[model samples]
Target chain A: MATIITKEQQEKEKMVTLVSSDSEKFVVEQKVAEKSHVIKMVMNCCGIESPIPVRRVKGDILKSILEYCEKHSKGEAQEVMEKWDKEYMDKAEKDLVFFHDLMLASHFLHIQELVDLIAVTFAGMLKMKSPEEIRQKFNINNDLTKEQEEHIMTTFGWAFQPI
Target chain B: MEVCGVPPEQDKTKGFSINDNADLLAEILSRLDGRSLGVAACVCRLWSGVCRRDTVWEALCTRHVSGGAATARAVVAALGGYRRLYRLCMGPVLERLPPARRDEAGHVSLSLSLSLSLFSIDCYERLGGRQRSSLLFLRNTVDVS
Candidate 1:
């Protein structure tokens, strides 16, 4: 299901079509679509006629992800992008489930940059927070017993040691 | 928010999906500070297990490197406890460490890169001293010099 797409196969003006899970099709410029690692492979293989079907991702998520690819394709200034990414992620994080789906979808698409960006963002949110606070953020639960829990705290005390 | 900050316990099975399972929970705890993660561990038995794992703690340590020694020490502690490190991938930055300090008293082994940076005895001792104090393990050691 996964194939490597080398750099040589990509051309600047090629055209491609992406079909969403719902059969909604989005015709994208090959230049913008190449940003997705998966599509790059398809182009590399010269496998035309197959409308790349992204079955797991919904239409809106696909749109946003493509918007990212399109904006990034312009070779925009890094400073401008850093500012945009910050704002982009800030708004994206608000819709937790949507953000999560986008992450999984990005993973499926094998968009390395997108995956790194989203993972780093999620990782950042988790930083310096308490386990409980983290659980609250993710709506997770504590399932271990008090004695079992204490054993861990005692055994791995070094992680808690002040530097 | 409750005093503990746990969402009001609606049901035991409420948020227990594979997506929010123990592994993910552990990942979340790893991002937190030690105190908060400690407090979270105390909230319940399951949380405690995930919080205490060296893998999780090691990740937290990795995240703290830029914060200062506290972060680096935390990572070292976590690494010390790990019987088998799941995955250790260091990028180019860690790749450029100078020669390891191996002195007469301590068999210190450093990459050639460190030899270039040794200006003072203090730096030399600190570089070599760590080897005398502990063993340094590198997956792939390159001679930079």
Candidate 2:
């Protein structure tokens, strides 16, 4: 015997469609979509019946962010969540360009936790590296005059000394 | 027209440069420690300018300073800015107390009267329990006479 499916039952499992900048559509559960504050605001004002257009985020980046939101919305145990977040970041860090895009997207979406995580990762890149190493890594030009560099180096000489 | 105070022209670029985004750059730099911050300040003109902002140094000072809010405020007020205050707090004086000042128990006794004179009436009172313990610690190592 086939169980009867009602319209209200289908409505109870309603989904929201999000369109990325490149016109790629992602159909996700409404709760998972609400993980992004930007989408939540859009839903509150414009109803979830229509697809929300995220014009600034690219398809791949939006997909990745949605994955993060889906996992986070589950409310897993603290230790498990931390382990997952670490693994997620580790994978993202493999491609600096993608990681940068993720950071920018998280910032635009008002996802504070992801922004903080990315910032910490960014800071970690410069943590123990010397000025020359940092300059090379970031492709930064040393614009400081000889005297200016020397003054800063000499004043905080301990920082330059081997730890 | 500006997204996060970044010029619209720079926002369309392929690669992200720290120089192109002020808010993101500041957010990343704020997570660095004093030593890392010092090295970052020498990276380039843009970074040097960002690292020199009082807000960055203030965050560093607040994290490193052990005393309460009153002590931090008093120190910052006396030193003029968080950068100067951080340098003084982390300087050689705190790291290596003069060997000549060590008491019989091998504790380096700071002069309580000198420290007390540095604080105003308001800060002195606000220091409360921390001031009392510090005074006791100092008194234990030094002679009053």
**B28-133, model 2: which lDDT tens digit per residue?**
9888877788888888878887888877776654543334534556555664566654454333333344534321222312322233333333244445745443
Model 2, runs deviating above 4 Å: A1-14, A154-156, B1-14, B62-79, B90-145
Q: Write down the worst ten-residue block by lDDT for model 2 chain A.
A: A1-10
TM-score: which candidate is best?
2
Report the C-alpha displacement of residue B137, candidate 1, in angstroms. Answer: 20
TM-score of each: 0.57, 0.71
Per-residue lDDT of A85-156 in model 2, one digit per residue for the tens?
Answer: 989999998767788889899999988888888898889899889889987666667888999888777756
User: Evaluated against the true chain A, what TM-score does chain A of model 2 have?
Assistant: 0.87
DockQ, computed on Cα atoms, for candidate 2: 0.35
- Residues A35-111 of candidate 1: C-alpha lDDT, one tens digit per residue: 88887887779664567887877888898899888888999999999888888889887767777767777777878
List, for all models, the DockQ compared with the true complex.
0.18, 0.35
Tell me the lDDT of model 2 at A89.
91
- Per prediction, fnat is 0.27, 0.60
